[model samples]
Target: MAQTVGDFLVERLYAWGVRKIFGYPGDGINDVFGALNRAGGKIEFIQARHEEMAAFMASAYAKFTGELGVCIATSGPGASHLVTGLYDARLDHMPVLAIAGQQARTALGGHYQQEVDLPSLFKDVAGAFVQQASAPAQVRHLVDRAVRIALGERRVTAIILPNDLQEEPYHEPGRKHGTLHSGIGYSRPKTVPYDADLHRAAEILNSGRKVAMLVGAGSLGATDAVIAVADKLGAGIAKALLGKAAVPDDLPYVTGSIGLLGTEPSYTMMMECDTLLMVGSGFPYSEFLPKEGQARGVQIDLAPDMLSLRYPMEANLVGDAAETLRALLPLIEQKTEKSWRADIEKNVADWWKTLEERAIQPAVPVNPQRVTWELSPRLPDGVILTSDSGSCANWYARDLRIRRGMMASLSGGLASMGAAVPYAIAAKFAHPDRPVIALVGDGAMQMNNMAELITVAKYWRQWPDKRWIVCVFNNEDLNQVTWEQRVMEGDPKFDASQQIPNVPYHRFAELIGLKGIYVDRPQAVGPAWEDALAADRPVVLEVKTDPEVPPLPPHITFQQAMNFSRTLIKGDPREGGVIRETARQVLGAILPGGRGD
Candidate 1:
C-alpha cells in the first residue's frame, strides 16, 4: 500500500494524539475522507449534521480536554461554515485546527466550481496560522507546524489541501517514499514573571487595605495559588464567566461572577476594593470594572498584550496563570485585619439567601431560576455543564453554584448561541463516564444544530452509561435581547421580533429515540431533573418558564430604572408583572430571615 499525502497527514494527526476528527464529508476533500477510512479505527470521524456544528464540536472538545481539536471541511461553503466556530475558539483562546480541502491545483485562477479564496476567508478567524499545502512533500511539515502553533498559542489554525496534492506520493529529495514517520518536535515552555515584576505586583497587592481578585478561564490550572493569595491578603475573589470554575462559590470571600450577569456582592466588592488583581482574564465590559484610577491594578497573563488591555495596571506580570501566582505567593504580605473580608462574606451570604427565596417562589409559569437551583444539588461530582447565551446564562451564572471538581463553559468571548448542545456532545465524547448537561434556551436550541440530539442517540450504545441531559428553558422569547432592547434603548416590547413560538423540545427528543421530560409547574422542576438523570438514554427536559421575569443587573442605573418606568407607562403589559416580581424580590431580601409573603 503506497502512502498518499492524505494518509501521511492522518498518521501525523494520530501521532499528535488526535483520536477523533469532527466534520462532514464533501466531494472536494474525498481523498482526505478516503485516508480517514483507511486509518481503520485508529481515528474516528464524527459526522455532524452541519459543518458549523462540526467546528463547534471541535472547539468545545479543545476547551474540555485542553488539547488541540481538529475539524475538517471541504472548500468554499464547507470552509465558510467553519468561520463562526473557529472565531469562538480564537476569541476564547481555545486550541483548534481546521483542515479544509481546496479545488485541484489545475483549477487555480480558473474560477472553478466551489472555488473560493480560503486564505482570505479564514484570515479573521485563523489569521494566527493559515497555510496551504502546495505539494505532497509539504503535507507533513504543514500539519506539524499547524498543530504546534495551535497548541502553543492557544488559537485557531488552518491548513488547506488541494485535491490533486492530497493523492500524490511523498518523495521529497533525500527522503524515501513512505519513510516519513518521525515525530514533530514541539513542546510548550513554562513562562513566568521576572523577579522584579513579581515583587512590584506583590507590593501593589500588600499596599491596599481592601484588595480584590478577578479570575478568568486562565486561572483554571492555578486554583490553589489564587486561593492562597486571596487568603493571604484577605481579598474578595470575583470570577469572569469563563472562569466560573476557577474557585468554588462556597468560599465565603468569593463573589461568584462579575459584570452584567453578576451578583450584588460581586458588584459591591468590585466598587469598594482599593486594589484589583486580575488573573488570566481580560474581561471586557469596562463599565463593570473598577472606575479608572479608583483602584490600582495588577494583571497576570500568559500573553503580554492581555495584561493591561482591559484596565490600566500598576504592574503587569506576563506569565502562565499558575506559574505567575506560584512565584508571587511568597512575596505577598499577609493582612491582619479581616474586616474587608468579613463585609464581603456577609454580602455574599445575604445574596445567596435572596437567590434561594427567588428560586422557590411559585409562578403561573415556572420561574427559570428554580430550574438551575434544583438541578445544582443533583449534579454528580465532576459534572460538566454547558450553558447557552441569553437569559439562561444569567440564571446559570447567578444561581448555579459550581462546586470544586465541577466544570462549566459557554461562548464567553463570541457570546454565540447554539454552542451549548455541541459543547455537551463534545464533553460527553471526551469523558463518557462523567455526567454532561447543556442548559439551553428555547430560542437557541432551535437555531442550527439541535439535531445533534439525534447524534447523541446514535452514539448512546457505544458509551458504558447514558449521562447526557439537555435541559431546555422553553421560554418562547429571545428573552435577553428583548430585555436589553427595552432597558438599554427604552424601546417598547416588540412582540413580532422578540417572541419565539413555543416548542415541545421534549417531544422532539422522544421522537428521536431519547428520554423526554416536560415541566410546566414549579413543583415539577426537581422531579423532572431526577427523571432525566435516571433515564437509561439521553434525555431532554423541556421546561416551560416565565418569559416576563427580567434578568435585571445586580446594580441597575437610574436611567435603566427610568426606562422601565417609561415602558410601563407606554402600555408594555409585562412591565407590571416584572415590577411586582421586583418588589417581591426586594421584600424577600430585606425581610427578617430573608422570607417573602
Candidate 2:
C-alpha cells in the first residue's frame, strides 16, 4: 500500500529531529495535521490560537535552539498571517521553515475558496519558496531543500503543499535527506591577509586623539574581541539598541545606545571622536553618525553588502570579527595616555546625572517612562522581558540593562503591535524555569490575538510553579500615536483623552484565569509588580498612567522644550489630574540630580 505524501513529510520531520510542530489545523491542511497526529509520540502538534503566534513561537525556538523552527498555515488569510513572523525571522537572520497549505493543484489559479498565489506572496521574505510538484519525490526534495536553506543560511524558507498533493499516494522510495546541523562552524574562506590594510587600521587607532567603538548585532558571537579592542585602544564603546548585550553596559568605557533614543554621552562621543570604528554594527540612523571632517568612520563587517550603507566609510574590512579584531590587537600599539576615554567617562557621568535628575523628581499619576525606568531595576536578575511596540519599546530599549543569558526580543522591522503576549508566551516556553514578564500597553494589546492568553493559561496549568507576568501600562489610549502626531503635525486633537473607549484590562485578565492587580496610583506599581512576580501562575499588573506625559526620547528635544513652555504658560491645568500628578512624582525624583546640559 502506498502512503500519502503528507505522511512521508511527517516521517522526514521526525528523521530531522523535530519533535514538536506549532501551528493551527484547518480544512486546507487537514490531511497533513491528521498525518502528524497519526505519527503518535514521534512528533507532536501544538495548536496556537493564531497562526502568527505559532510562527513567532517557532521563530524564537529557532533563535534559541539554533534548529529549524517550523510553523504552518492554511490557504490565503492563514498564509498572510504568517508573513509578519517570517519578516521578523528574515530580519533577525533566524532559521525557520514555514509549511503553508495551498489550495488543491486543480484550484490553484482559479477562483476557488481560500485560493491565492502562495509563492508570489512569500517571494520577498523567504530565502527559498517551493511549490511541491505532483510527484512524491518532488515533495521530498522540496522539504529537504527548505530545511537546508533555513538551517544552513539562517534564513526563513517556505514550502507550499497543495491539498490533493498532500493526500495523494506516494510512489517513490522516500529517500531521506541529510539532517540539518545547527552549529557555527563556518569554513575559513581563502584569504590573503591585507597587511597594509590591517596596519592602517592599527595606525589610525594608535594615532587617534579620541576613538569610540559602535557595536552592532553581528558582533554577538565576537563580544570578547570587541571588548578587547575597546580596552586596547582606550576607546569608549556604545551600541545600537539591538546590540545592548554585545558589551557590558556598566563598564566605565561603555556609554549607552546611540540612535533616536540614545544618551547625551553617546551622542557627544560620536560628535567628538577623531575615529569611529564600527565593529559588526549596522546603525540605521545615519543622523547619529558624525558628518565628514568631524569624525572618520571605519566599518568592519562579515557581509560586504552592508558595508558603508549607513555612513560613508573610509575603510571596509571583510573578515570574521573575532579573528580580525584579535589580529588588530597585536598590531596596534596601546594608547599611552589618551584623554578621550576620560572625556567620554565624564560625559557618561553627566548623562547619568541627567537621568537621575529626571527620575528622582516624581509627581502624582506618574509619567510612564519614569515609572518604567524606575521599575525595571526592581525586577530579578535573569528575568526575561518582552516589550510591545510603541513608545514602551523605545523606553525599555533606552532604560533597561540586560545581563548575560537574559533574553529580550521584539519586532525588529515590522514593529507590530500586540507582539508582547505572543513573544512573552514564547519566552516563557523557551525558558520555563525563569520569570518572564511582558510590558504591554492596553491599546496595543487589543490588536493582538488575545485568545493566546488561553495558551498562556494552559501552559501555566501544565507548569503551575512558573512565574509569567504581563504588565499592562494602561493609559486608556494610544498615547504613542498621540505623541507622534503631536510631533509631526502639532495636532492637539490627537490627545488620548479626546478619543478611545475604556476597556477593563483587569477583567480581561480574569477571563484567562490569570490574577489581575489594578493600580490607580503610580506609587502602587512597584509593590504590585513584586506581588505579581511572587504569584505561582501568570499575573497581569495594570498600571493606570497619565497619557499626556512629555515624550522621553534620550535627546532633550525642541518638541519637549515647546511642550514644557506651553504647559508652564498654561499653569499645567488639571484634567484627569492624574497626568500632572504623574509628572510631579517623576520630577521630584529628578530634582536632586540637577538639570541636563
Candidate 3:
C-alpha cells in the first residue's frame, strides 16, 4: 500500500522516539487518528477527557522525563482548548509538540463547521515554529522540523494538519519516498562559558565577605557542581520553586525556597548576603532577591537572555550549569569563615521548628500544614510529587522537603490551578515504577477537569506496581484568592465569590471505583495518608481543613499587616480566631519552644 501523509508523519514521530501522544479525537483530525491506530503499539494514544488536560499531561510529561512531549487536538474548540497548557509549557521552558487538525482546504476562508484559524490561535504560545501542511509533500518535512525546533529550543512547536492533506498520498514521479525515516535525529548542543568569563565570575565571588547561591530548574543536571560552588565559598543556597529538586534540602546551608512562597531563612539569607550567584533559574520575583547595589551578582545560564534577567549582574557567564560551575570552581578562593554559614544554618533550623509548631496547632478543622508535614516523612525515596496553585502550594512549598532522589514541580510560571491532577497523571505515565502523589486544593480540583480522576481509574490496572495518591485539601474555599482579596484590598470577610460549594471528593472517587479516605480531624491525617498509600488501587485522601487559616508570606509588609487589621476592624466574624492564629504564628517564629497552643 502507498504511504499516506498521516502515515508518513506518524513514522517520523516514531523515528524521533515519541512513545506516547496525549489528546482527544474529533472529525477534523480523524485521519491522523487513523494513522495513530495503524502505528499500533509503536505509539500509545492517551485519550484525555479534555484537550486542556491533554496539553497539561504533555507539558508534565516533558517536565518529568526531559523528553519531547506531544499532544493532538481537532479543529476549532479542540485546538483552542490547548492554549492554556501550551502557555504552561512555553513559560516553564518544557519542550512540547502540539498537533491540531484544521478544516478541509476546500473550506478555507469559508464559514465551515469547526473552522478556526489555528496558526493565528497558537501564534503566541507555539510561536517558535507554527506551520500547516497545506500540501501532501509538506507533511514529512513540517513534522521533522517541528520536532527538531521543540527539542532544540525547549519551547512549544505546532503543526496544523488539514483534513484533505492528511489523506493525500506521499508519492512523486522521480522523488524518493520515506526520506523522513532516513533523516530524523535530535541532539542537544553543549554550551560552556569562555575562560575569561569564568575567571571574572570567580573574582566577583571571592571579593565579597558573605556569598549565597540561588538555584533554579536549570541546575537539575548540575546538582554536584552547585553544591561544590556553595561549599567552596561558604555560601548558603536558596532554591527557586522550580529548582526545589536541584539539590536536597537537608544540606546544612541550603535554604528551601525563595519567593512569595519562600521560607523565612531563605529571605533572611538573601537580604544579608553581599554576593549572589544565580544558577539555571530565571526566578521572576525580584522583591525576594537582594536590592540592586546591595549585592554584587554573578549568573550562569545556558540561555543568554536569562543570564541577568532577574537581578542585575556584574558578571554573566553564558554556559551550561554543570560545565560552567566545573570551570569556575578552580578559580574560586575557598572561604575559611564559618560564622556566616553557621548563622544561616541556625535560622533554617529555627524556621523548620516554626513550621512544625504551626502544623500541629489544634483547631476545629484540621490545619492544612499538618497534611504536608505528616506526608513529608512518609514519602518513599524517589517519589514524584506535584502541587496545585493556591494555598495548597504555599504549604507544599514551605512544608514538603525534596530529599535526594525525589522530584517535584507544579505550574510555576503559569500558576494555573487545575495543573496538579494532570501533572500527577503525566508523571505516573512517565515514571510508572516510581510512586506518584498530587497535593491539590478543593478549589483547583473542581475548577477544571476533575473528570481526569476517571482517567486515573482507567489506567490504574495497566501499571500494577505503581501507586498514585491524590491528597485533597477540602477547605470549601478558594482560600488563596480569598486571602489575596483581603490582604490586597483590605476587604471584610465576603464569601460572595470566594467560597466553593463543598463536594465529597472521597465519595466521588469511590463512585469511580478508586479507594477513598476522608479525614475531618487532625488525628486522622496521618492514618488516612498511610491507608491511601497502602491501597492497591488509585486513592483520593480528602482532608477537611480550616478556611480561616491564611498562608502568610515569610515577610509580611507593613501594608499587609495594616490590611489585616482593617479587615478585623470592619466587623469580620472570624476576627478573634484570626488574631489568635496570627499570634500563634508570631510566637512560633520568636519563641524557642516547639509546638504552641
Candidate 4:
C-alpha cells in the first residue's frame, strides 16, 4: 500500500526525535492528525485550548531540547495567533516549526473559511517559510527543508499545508529534515590589540579607585573569561537581568543585577563605579547608567554591532569573550590590596541581609516577592524556573537564583506572557530527570493554553518526577497591569477588576485528572508545596494572593514611587494605611526612601 502524505510527515517528525506534537485539529488538518494518532504512541497528539499556547509550548520545547519543536495550527486565526510565540522563538533564537493548515488547493487566494497568506504573515517572525505545493513530492522536500532551517538556523519555521496536500498519496519514503545551521560562517573579527589601548584601559581600572563589570545575556557562554577579567582588574561583577545566570551569585565579585527593577547592590555599584566594563550585554535601561559623562568604560563583544550601541566605549574588543579575556589576562597587572573588593562584597552582603529580613516579616495577604523568595530557597538544584511577564517577572528577575548546573531561560528583551506552562513542559521533556516548574500570574496564564495540563499529565504517567508543576500566584486580578495603569493614568480605579473573577483553578485541575492543591493560608503554602512536589502526577498549586502587593525591585522610578504614594495616601488611612506602612517597611530600609530618577 502506498503511504499517504499525512503518514509521511508523522514519520519524518518521529525520526526528528519529536515525541509529542501540540495543536488544535481542524477539518483541513484532520487527516494529518489522524495519521499522527495512527502512528500509535510514537508521536503523541497534545490538544491545546488555543493555537497560541501550542506555539508557545513548541517554542519552549525547542529551546529545552535544542531541536525543532513542532506545533500545528488549522489556518487563519489559528495561524495568526501563532505569531506571538513565533516572535518569542525568533527573538530568543529557539528552534520551532509551525505546521499550519490552509484552505484547499482549489480555493487558493479565494476567501474560503480559513485562508491567509502564510508566507507574508510569517515573514518577520519566521527564519524560513514554505507552502506545500499541492504535490506529495513538494511536501516531502519542504518538510525536510523546514526541519533543517528550524534546528540548524535556530529559528522558527512555518509550513502551510493545504487540505488536499495532507490527503495526497505519497510514493517516496519520508526523510527527516537535517538540522538547520545558523551563524556558522560569521567568524569573530580579529582584534588588532593596541598596546596603548590595553595600557589605557588598565590605567583607567587602576586609577578609577573603583570599577565594576556589567555583563549581559550575550556573555552567557564565556563565564571563565569574565571571572578572570574581573579578578585581574579588581572589578566587582554585576549583571543585567538577562545575564544573571552567567556567574554564580555567591562569588565574592558578584553584585547581583542592575536595571529599572534592580537589586540594591547593583544599583549601588552602578552609581559608585568610577569605571565600567560592559561585557556582551545590551542593557536597555539607560536610566541605570552612570551619571558621570567622563566615566571611562570598555565594551567587549564578539559582534561589533552590539558594542557601543547602548553606551560610548573607550575600548572595544570585537572578538569572542573568552579569546579576548585570554589575550587580556597576561596584559592585566594584578591588584595588591583587597580593600575595594572587600568593600563591594560587604555592601552586597549588607543589602542581602536587609532583603532577607524584609522577606520574612509577617503580614496578612502575603507579600508576593517574599513568597517567591521563600519558594526559591526550597526549589531543588537544577530546577528549571520559567516565569511569565508581569509583576511575576519582577519577582523572578530579582529573587530567583539559578544554582550551578541549572538551565535558566526567559524572554529577556521580548518579555511576553503565557510562556510559563510551555517552558515547564519543554524543560520536563528535555531533562526528564530534573524538576521543572513554572511561576505565572493568573492573568498571564489565562492568555496562553493553561489546558496544557493535559500534556503534563500524560508525561507524568510515564515518569513522575518529570511531572510539570504550575505554581500560579493567583491574585484574582491582573495586578501587574493595574500597577502599570496606575503609573500611566494615576487612577487605581482602572484595574483588571472586570476581567478577573474568583475562579476555582485548583478544582479545575482536579477535573482534568491531575492533583490540585489550593492555598489560601500562607501557613499552608509550605506543606502544599511539598505535597505537590511529592505528588506522583502533574499538579497545580493555585496560591491565592494579595493583588495590591507590588514586587519591590529597589530601583523603581521616582514617578512610580510618587504614584504609589498617591495611591496609598488618597485612600482611607485605616485600610490603605496598611499598604502604606508595608511600603514604608520595605522601601524605608533602603537609601533615602526615594526612587530612581
Candidate 5:
C-alpha cells in the first residue's frame, strides 16, 4: 500500500520532533487519524473532551516543556473552537501548531457542510503561518514551515487538510516551475546584543542607587543571570505573574508577584526605585511600573517590538535574556550599598507576615488564601503547578511558595478561565515522572474543567507518578468578576450572573476512580493536601471556600475604597458576609492573634 498525504503529514511532523498531539477528532479528520494509528505510536495523539481544552493543553505543553506544542481538530466548529486557546499561546508567545481537517476539496467555495473559511478564521491566531494543502507535494513544505515558523517565532501556526485530498497518494514536488521542496529541523540560535549595546545597558543599570528589576516568562531560564544582576545592582526583584517560577519565592530580595494580583512590596519597590531593569517581560499595565521618566529604565528582550513597550528604556538591548545578561554582567558594577537591599527584604518579610495574618483570619467555612498558604510549604520538589484564572489566581500568585526546581504557569497573557486542569494534564503528560497540581475556581470547574477530569481518568494509570491533583476552590460565585464589579465598577455583586451552583466536586472525582478529599474547615486544608500527596492515584481535593473574601489589589486606590463603600451602601446580596470578611482582612494585619470573619 502506498502512503497518502495524511501519512506524509504525520511522518513529517514526527520528523520535526513532535511526539504528542492534543485534540478531538471528527469525520473530517478521519484520514489523518488513520495515519496516526498506522504510525504505531511514533507520535501519540491524546484526545481531549473538547477542541478548546486540547488547544489549552497544547499551549501549556509548550509552556512547560519549551518545545513545540501541537493540536489537531476537524473542520468548521472544531477549527473555530481552537481560536481562544490558540490566542492563549499567541499572547503568551508559546510555540504551537494547530492541525485541522477541512471539508473535501471538491466542495470548496460551494458551501459544503463543515466547510468554514478556515484560513480566514485562523488568520489572526495563527498569523505566523496558515496554509491549506491542495496537492500531496504541498503537504510536506506546509508541515515543515508551520512547525518551523511556530518554533522560530514563538507564535501559533496552522495547517488545514481537506479530507478528500488527505486520502490521495503522496507525491514529491516535481522538478518544475512553481514547485519547491522544503526540509525539516530548526535549532534556536544564540542571540545577544553587541559589545557596545551590552555596555550601554550596563552603564544605565550600574548608574542607579535604588535599582528595581521586573522579570517575566522570558526570564524563566535565566534565573542565575537574573540573581546575579539583581545582586550587583542591589535591586529588589519583582516577578510578573508569568515569572512566578523564574525566581524562587525563597529569595529574600524577591518581592513575589507584581500587578493587580501583586504584592504590596512590589508596588512599593516600583514606586520608590530610581532606576529599573526589565528582562524578558511584557507585563502590561504601566501604572504598576515606575512612572514614565521617574526612573531610568533598561530592557533586554529577544523581540525588539516588546522591548521598552511597558516602560521607556534608556537602553533597549535586543537579545535573549540569559545571554544578554551574561554578556552585560562583566560591565555591571556591583553596588556595595546594603541599605537599599535591606529595605526591600524587610518589606518582603512584612508582606509575607501580612499574608499569613490574612490567611489565618476565618471566613464562612474556609479562607481561600489559607488553602494555598498551607499548600506552599508542602509543595514537593520538582512539582509542576498550574492555576486557572479568577479569585484562585490571586491566592496562587500571592500565597504559593515556589521553591527551586518547581515550575508554575497559568493562562498568563490570556488569563483565561477553565485552563488550569487542562494545563495540569499537559504538564503531567510532558513529564510523567514529576508530580503535577492545579489550583482552580468553581466557576472554571463548572465551565469546562469538570469534563477534563475524565481525560485524566483515561490516562492517569499510564503516568509513572500518580501524584496528579486538582484542588478546587469551591466558591459558588464568579469570585473575581464579583470583586471587580464591586471595586472597579462600584456595583454590588449581581447574583443573577455571578452566582454558580454548588457542586460536589470531590464526589465527582470519587466516582471516576480518582481519590477525593473534601475540606470544609481551615485546619483540614493542610491535612487534605497531605492526603492527596500521599494518594496512590490522581486526586481531586475540593475545599468549600468563602466567596465574599475579597481578592484585594496590592495598593488599593482611594477610588477602590470608595467603590467598596458604595457597594455595601447599595446593599449587596451578601452584604453581611462581605462586610465581615472585608473587615477581618483589613484588621487581621494589625490585630494580634486575629482570626475569624
Candidate 6:
C-alpha cells in the first residue's frame, strides 16, 4: 500500500508521542479521516460536538499530561473555531498543536466552499509556528517543527494541510540544495538561574521578618520544595487559582486562593507581608498583591518575560520553579521566630470557621457555598476537579479544600466559560483510572456544557472508572456578572442580560442515559454527591442555588462597599433577596461588629 501524505502525518505524530487527537470532522479534511481509518486506531480520535470544545480538550490534555496536545479540524470555519481554545493554551502557557485542513492548492484563491486562509487565522494564537504545507514532502518538517516548538515553548502552534496535498503520495525531501529534513523528539532542558541571582533572591527572602509566598501553575512539581522553603523562611504560602493543588489546603499556614475570589487570610497576608516570593504565576490582579513598594519582591519563572511582570521584583530569577527553589534553599537562612507563622495559622483556622457559618445560611433554595463545603470532606481520594468561570469558581476557590493527592484546575488565565466539561473529559482521558468531576454554572451549562453531556454519553462506557460527574449550579442567573454589575459598576442587576432560563440540568442528563440527581435543599447536597459518586455510570448532580447570595471578595474595599449600597439604592429587581443575603453574609463578617475594611 502506498503511503499518502495523511498517513505519513499520522505516523510522524505517533513518532512524536501523540496517542490521541480531539476534533470534529468536516468535508474539507475527509482525506485525513480516511488515513485515520486506515491507520487502525494508532491515535484515538475524539469527536467533539464542536471544534471549539476539541481545542479546549487539547489545551487541557496538555495541562494534565505535561506532554504535547494535538487537535485537528477542517478548513474555514472549522479552523477558525480553534482560536479561543488555542488562546486558552497560549495564555496559560500550555503546549498544544492544532492541525487544520486548508483549501486545495489550485483552488486557493478561487473562494471555493470552505476555502479559508488558515495560516493567517491561526497566526496570533499559534504565532510561534504556523505554516501551511505546500507539498507532500513539506509535511514532515511542518509537523516536526510545530510539535517541537509548541512543547519547548509551552505555547500553541499550528500546521495547515491542503486537501489536495493530503491525498498525494508521501515523499522524502530530496538530497539537494533548497531541500530540508526534520527529525522527531524534544526534551525540556534543565533551566535554572545563576548562583548569584539565587543568592540575591535568598537574601531578600531572609531579610524580611514577614515573608509571603505566591505559587502558581508553574509550581506544580515543586510542591515539596515550596513547603520546605516556606517553612525555612517562616512564611505563609498563598495559591493562585491555577496553583490550588501546588500545596495542600490542609497546611496550617497555607492561604487557599488569592485575588477577587480569594480567602481573607490571603488578602490579609498580602497586605501585611514585608517581602514576596512569587513562583511561576501570572496572576493579573496587582491590587490583590502587596501595594507597590510595601513589600520587597522576588520572582522565579522559567520564562524571563514573565519575571517581574506582575510585581516589581527586586530579584528576578529566571529558572524552572522546582530547580530554582532547590538551588536557592541552601542559601536561605531558617527563621527561628514562630510568631508570624502562628498568626497566619490562626487566621486560616478562623477563616475556615467563618466560611462554615456562611455556608449554612438560608437561601431561596440552596446556598451555593454549602454545596462545595459539604462535598469537600466527602471527596474521594485522587479525584480530579474542574470548575467553570463564574460564581461557581468562587466556591471552587474558597470552599473546596484540595488535598495533597487531588488535582483541581479550571480556566485560569482566560477564565473562559464552558471549559469545565471539556477539561474534565480530557482529565478522564489522561488518567482513566482516576475519578473526575466538573462544577459548572447554569449560564455556562446552557452556553455549551449541555451538548458535551451527549459527548460523555458517547464515550463513558470505555473509561474504566465511571465516577465522572458534572455538578451544575442551577441559579437561573449569570450570578458572577450580576454581582459584578452591582459591586463593580454600581448598577442594579439588569434582568434582560443577567437572568437565564431555569434549566432542568439533571433531567437532561437522565434523558441522555446518565444518572441524574437534583437537590433543592441544603441538607441534600452531601447525600446527592454521595449518590453521584456511587452511580454505575456518569452522573449529573444539579443543585438549585440562590443567585442573590453575593460572591463576596475576601475583604471589600470602601469603594466596593459603596457600590454595594449604591446598587441597592438605585433599585434592583432582586433587591429584597440581595439586601438580605448581603447583610447576612457580608456586613455581619466584613464590617461594623466584624473586621473593618
Question: Between which residue pairs do clashes occur in model 4?
Answer: 148-180, 152-180, 152-181, 153-180
* CA lDDT of every candidate: 0.87, 0.72, 0.87, 0.72, 0.92, 0.91
Task: State the lDDT of candidate 6 residue by residue for 475-534, as single tens digits.
Answer: 899999999998888899999999999878999999999999999999899889999999
Identify the candidate with maximal TM-score: 6
Tens digit of lDDT per residue, candidate 5, span 1-597? 899998988899999999999999998899999999999999999999999999999999999999999999999999899999999999999999999999998899998888899999999999999998888989888988999999999999999999999899999999999987899899999999889888887888888999999999999999999998898899999999999999999999999999999999999999999999999999998999999989999998888899878998999988999999998888999899899999999999999998998888878899999999999999999999999999999999999988999999999999999999999999999999999999999999999999999999999999999999999999899999998998888899898999999999999999999998999999899989999999999999999999988897887776776777777789888889545556556544433455533
lDDT-superior candidate, 4 or 5: 5
Candidate order by lDDT, decreasing, is 5, 6, 3, 1, 4, 2
Q: How many backbone clashes does candidate 4 have?
A: 4
Candidate 1 wrongly placed segments (more than 4 Å): 173-183, 573-579, 583-597
TM-scores for all candidates: the values are 0.96, 0.87, 0.96, 0.84, 0.98, 0.98
- Candidate 2 Cα outliers beyond 4 Å, as residue runs: 127-132, 171-200, 463-465, 493-498, 556-597
Alpha-carbon runs more than 4 Å astray in model 4: 3-20, 30-46, 127-153, 169-209, 291-305, 314-333, 464-467, 487-489, 493-499, 569-575, 586-597
Instruction: Please provide, for model 4 over 271-334, each residue's C-alpha lDDT reduced to its tens digit, 9 standing for 90 to 100.
Output: 8877888877878876677774746778777556677777777787665566666777777778
lDDT of 3 by residue, 1-597 (tens): 778888888888999999999999998888889999888778999988899999999999999999999999999999999999999999999999999999999998998889898999999999999998777766767877899989988999999999888888875333566444325788888788878888888899999888989999999988899999899999999999999899998897888889988998999998989999999998999999999999999998877888788889999988889988998899999999899999999999998898998888876579888999999888888899999999999989889878889999999899998999999999999998889999999988898747999999889888855589999999888888877766767887677887789899999999999988999989988888888888899899999998777787787776776676677678665566644565446434333342443
Better of 4 and 5 by TM-score: 5
Q: Where does model 3 exceed 4 Å of error?
A: 172-182, 583-597
What TM-score would candidate 3 get against the native? 0.96
**Alpha-carbon error at 7 in model 6, in Å?**
0.3
Pick the winner on TM-score between candidates 5 and 6. Answer: 6
Q: Mind sharing the TM-score for model 1?
A: 0.96
Comparing 1 and 6 on lDDT, the stronger one: 6
Ranking by TM-score: 6, 5, 3, 1, 2, 4
Evaluated with lDDT, which candidate comes out highest?
A: 5
Better by TM-score, candidate 6 or 2: 6
Candidate 6 global CA lDDT score: 0.91
Per-residue error for 126 in candidate 1, Å, reads 0.6
